[model samples]
Every structure is written in structure tokens, then in C-alpha cells.
Target: MTSLQHVSTISAPLPAPSRQPFALALSILLTAGLTGYLFNAQDSHASLVLLLGAALGITLYHASFGFTTAWRTFITTGRGKAIRAQMLMLAVAVCLFFPALSAGELFGQPVNGFVRPLSVSVLFGAFIFGIGMQIGNGCASGNLYHAGGGQLRAIPSMIGFAAGALWATRDYEWWTTQPSLAPVGLIDMMGVVPAIILNLLVFAAIAGLTRHLEKRRHGELERDDNGSDQPWSRRLLSGPWPFIWGAVALAVLNFATLALIGRPWAVALGYPLWGAKAAEAMNLGLDVDFWGYWLMPGRDTALMGGILEDSASLMNIGVILGALMAATLAGRFSLSWKMPVLQWLAAIIGGLMLGYGATIAFGCNIGAYFGGIASGSLHGWLWLVAAFAGSFVGTWLRPLFGFSRT
Candidate 1:
């Protein structure tokens, strides 16, 4: 008897659900809630408004940089001096901060944020964060914005980062109790004018270094006939207007986020919050002080208590939505889940490292490095050094982990 052969078709497992929608919704709701809280909250800092402006500026910068052909070339070609621009901006920010602090009008109010110098913790934290970013495929700021654009890898990286952060937060007290590397608030000594001049000098030095490097590399490319030897001027002007404007706009957005939120832009804390909540939900009995120490909660008065709720959580939500809106409008949005399992694992691990490292550093690249530099903190510079060193190490290991060189 010829039995009817029953054949079952096996299909590859369906890709993980896109969390973009959830991310978007959560962002909107959180933003709305925070806005309401700010409007209704009795105690407020005037510096917040200026911080908001900075946040806006940051957003503009990112968007513009991403879309701009010129900026892209500067980033990818190594010939265009994007790094120089960044250094210039950092110097400018440092100069501006001291003047602003002295004049009490930099952000339209007296500057209150304390500026601190480098520390051992900052160096160590930066190394860890830098390595984490390389493995996760983006830095803290890069991850939030990119994840919004539908990079599945970013999701895992973000998760890992948060987990790491949570772990770090639990140990924050001990970390802070350690000895600091330099005197806190070095900018306070030099005041505004000298600081600005110093920064400009540094900028000039970096420009000279960049020019030297470019000239050295020019002949090699010419001999190879790679057609990659574009002039700096041409590279700077290659992208359309939107790209340039978009980056500037993002920079403004970053400023705005800070002003309104009363904190610099960040992303790792959200993950830690989630982790903490999960731990609590599972009855793990984690210490509340751990979260509280990280400014997870605000101060409390006899009549009322302040809470440091998750601001980044909302900001991240908005970031994803904003990016999604941009991508969807431009037809650049696509669903992708093509990463290999090992890479996925790496992303998660890297993210966790980022989370922990960022917490120990008291911020991620955005909050600590970018904002820190802009705020005239010496630790910012240290972070860059450590992180870049870590990035180099990460790059060396990438091939071994199946990552493409490109």
C-alpha cells in the first residue's frame, strides 16, 4: 500500500518582533509625562532652558552629520577634518562654559554644574565604554539614535548596556569613595578667557596634526589611483544642505533635552531602571539606595519628596520616534534581522558592558564625554583617550568575532 507521503515544510524561525513601535509609543508617553511634570513641578532650575537649547543643538548635529555627504566624507574618508571640527567644538564649548559661568548667562542663567578634572575611574570607565561601543557597533548616543532606525543589533547592545549599568549602579558608592586623579574643577582657576584661549590653542594643534596626517596619506592614495584623494574643501561641501542643517539641528536638540530635563543626554540608565524593576518584580530585594545614589530619585522635603524617574527612557523613546519619522519619511527605514547568533551574543555582551561602564563614569558618551567636555570637565578628555584606546582593541578583535572590516 502506497501511503500518502505527508511532507511538512520547515521554515526558518520568524524574526524577532520589531520593538520600534513599542519604543515609539513609550517615548511619546514619557515625553508627555515629563513635560507635564516640569510644568507642574514647583522647584525648577533656570539653567534648564539653556540646557534644552543645547540638547536641540546636539540633535541637529547628529541628523545633519548623518545625512550630509560632506560630514559623511569627513567621518569615513579620514581626509576631511571632521575630528578637527569636533575638537574645535570642544574647545569652543570649554571656552564658552567658563565665560558663561562667570557672566551667568551662557545658558541664560548662572552656571551651577560643577566642573571636575580627570580621575582613575573616568579613565577605566572610558576604556570599558569604548570597547563596549565597538563590540555593540555604536556608542551610547549612536546606539539610541541608530536603534530607532531599526538596527536589531542595537537593541541587544542597548539591553546589555543597561544590564551593565544596573550592575555598576549597585557598586557606585564604592567607586565614588575611591581617590580622584586630579583636582576637581580645574576650569575654576583659569576662568573663562584663559580657558577659551587654551582650548583654541589645542584646536590649532589638532588641526596641524590632522593636516600633517592627510598630507602623508595623500601620496599613497594617488599612487594607488584609488580616486579617494578628495580635497578637504571639496569633501566639506559635498553633501546636500539637509545633511549639514540636520546635524546642526540635532546639536540644538541635544541642548534642549538638557535644559528641559535638567541633565545631559544619556541612554544607559533606562536599561538599568528596567533591570532594577525586573529585579524588584522578581523579589530580589535589591537596595533602593543603589538606584537612589545615581540620581534615580530626586531629593525629598518634609512636605514633598522628589524622585529621579527615568528621563532617558523618555528621551530614548523620542529619539527612536524622531529617527523613525525621519527614516520613514525618507524611505530609508527597513526591517532587518540578519545578524548571526554569535554576533547577537556579542551585541548583548557589549551592551551590558556599556551599561556598567557608563554608570561608573556617571554618564555615557553623550552625558559624560560630549556634555562633560562642553561643560568644561577635564574628565571628558580622559574619557576620550581611554575609550579610543579601547576602540582600537575592539577593532582588532572584530575580525575574530566575525565582524566585517567595513
Candidate 2:
């Protein structure tokens, strides 16, 4: 869902040769074993989903397509290049998804886009998520790929995500009382062409606005594209890819997801389900009917099922493994086992916020922001505005965590 920026162009400007054969071997073995398990445990579709997740991870890693970093850079430096990428990604996804969704099927399977209710929860959740991104230093998808690339900090954030997600889901028994608008689909409400035109107009306006701001602030979109002289083949296999490619890959894969799974891309839904499974293992007397969301749309089954049975979970695994493979091939795998207390605390706190905010908001950067907007849900637009505002405030708070400029 990135949005990337001048802050850290994807892949760290052609990563220096930093290979680990052991890591490479381990990654290969892990990928093979997982693929085998999925094929045997469920079916080819499950294995395919896992492979797609890995592809997402690889594309995200090599391209360094990041939502949190991109938005943070914009908030602090007024660089809108990454934000532009985010817009482009959304536009591409909508262009592909809307038509298929309107058609109601792809290859004989029913197709649908994410269209959650616009609610007070979205307002609160998105704003908190914005602030959380600053503290966490990564969005939901960002953490998965980064963790795979050996960023130890993301591990704690992930743990916190599970905690926050479970907590909020468990607490939603009361939160559901908040007001919400009935769900609406632009295609159904105003027809597909009009919806596309309206969304494109918004996208163009934003892009234009950002270009103006970037010029007024930094005189132009900042770039390091010319700084690197890496060979094309090397860049393709073991290095930094341009952000545009990341956007393209995400759009294509999301479309493939629709064709394969009958839905657009999503990542965070797996968090709570994982937590529920954990609670059940601990004999916490977890009930599927404790909160209504779990019972809606066959979610209870996904909650009770194994990881391989959940599309989002399988995709998440693929993303992590894909990032690992990409990092290994690019020779950029490094894990630090040490961290300052404040930073660690920030990571944990931020992660909890990410989980809570996203859960309550109905999705994270991926689900709510990307999938929501692509699905033509108005709440996604609201999520963007609130999250951006929160990010603005978060930039100021970053200094407290020893972050020079988050």
C-alpha cells in the first residue's frame, strides 16, 4: 500500500553484497516445506495463495513499497512522491477491481471488493492507526516484510498487533453500539463508469495538489534514482527496484487474488484469528459468539481453522518468506538482537495501536485504505484523511522516542 519516499528508496540503493548461504538454504528449505504442507494439507489453491504471498513479500522488499515510511516522510518533509505512489496503487487497483466486481464474477467465481460500513469506529481507528504507524515505524504489511528481512523490532510490533487485535475484537461487544452508515458501493450507487471517473478525478486532484506542495516545499520530488549505477540484471535479481514496479506488482497480484480467491488483497484479518487460536490453546474459554464480527461471513470457521486454511494468513506467510528470499538474494539480511528501552516500548505501543486501530477501523493500511478505496467504499476515503491528520500529529511525537524525524 505504499507510498514510498526519498527517505529510503526500496531496497536500500542496491544493497551491498551481503550474502548468507546458510540463510539462503534455510529459506529455500522453509519455502519448500511450507509449499509441500499447503499442497498436502489443503489443496493447490492454498499453496498458490502462499506462493502469491511470497511474491508480494518479494515485490514489497525489492521495491521497498512502504506505507508508514512514505506517509511519515510526507508529514515531516512535505515530499509527496511516495504519496503519489500510494494514489497510483489505489487507482490501479480500482481500475482493475471495479470492472470485475461490477461483472460479479471472474472465471465463473463470484468476485467482490471490500466495502465495509462507514462508522465512528473508522474515524477513531484510522486516526489512531496513523499515529501508531509513526510509533511502530511500519504498517501491517511493512512489518511483515521487514521482519522477514531480519528487522528484529518488527517482531515485537507483530506480537503487539496480535494482542491489540484480540483485545479489540473481544471488546467490540460494547463498541458496536457506535453509530454507522449503511454500506454503499459506488458501482451500485452511481454505476461503474461514473464511479471510476469520480475516483480518478479525486486521484488527479490529489496528485496535482501534492506536486504543487512538493514544489513549494522542496522545489521538486526528491529522488536518488540517478545516484545508483547498478546493472539492470543485478537490480532485478538482488537489489533496489523502483517504486513504480512495486505498485504495479501489488496491483497485478491483487487482481490475481481476486481471480483466485474471489476477493481483493488483505493482510491484518489474520491477526485476531491467530490470537483466538492462541486463546483457545490456553483454554481461555473463547466463544465464537462472544463478539458478533467473528460470526459474520463464515469468519468463525476461519478463526477455528489452521493457518493454511486462512487466505490472509497464508498470504502473510508468503510475504514474510518472499521478503526473506528477496533479501537473501539481494544479500541484505541482518538481524539485530539489541534495542534501546524507549524504542522497544515505542514499537510495542505502536503495534498495539496498529492492531486496535485497524481492527476497529475494519482494516489496516491494506484492508481499510487500499482495499477499501479500491472497492469504492467511502469509509476508505475517510480513513485516508483521518490517518493523514494523525500522521501529522505523530511526526511531532516521534522526537520523544529518539526518532529524529519519523
Best by TM-score: 2
Question: Best lDDT goes to which candidate?
Answer: 2
RMSD of 2: 2.4
Q: What is the C-alpha RMSD of each candidate to the true structure, in Å?
A: 10.7, 2.4
CA lDDT of each prediction against the hidden true structure? 0.53, 0.81
Query: Mind giving the per-residue lDDT tens digits that candidate 1 earns over 59-133?
Result: 422233321122223333445344554555455455445555455443553344435546667777878877676
What TM-score do all the candidates reach, one by one?
Answer: 0.72, 0.94
After superposition, candidate 2 runs with Cα above 4 Å error:
1-18, 224-228, 285-289
lDDT of 2 by residue, 1-406 (tens): 3221232244235544455777877887899899998899789999899999999899888788878877777777888777787778878888988888999999898998888888889899999989888876778999898888887668888888888888889776566789989887898898889999999889889988988988999876766362257777787777577667777788889889889999878898888887777777888886745577687676878876787799989999999999888878877677754667887888898889888888899898888888888888898898999888878777678879877674
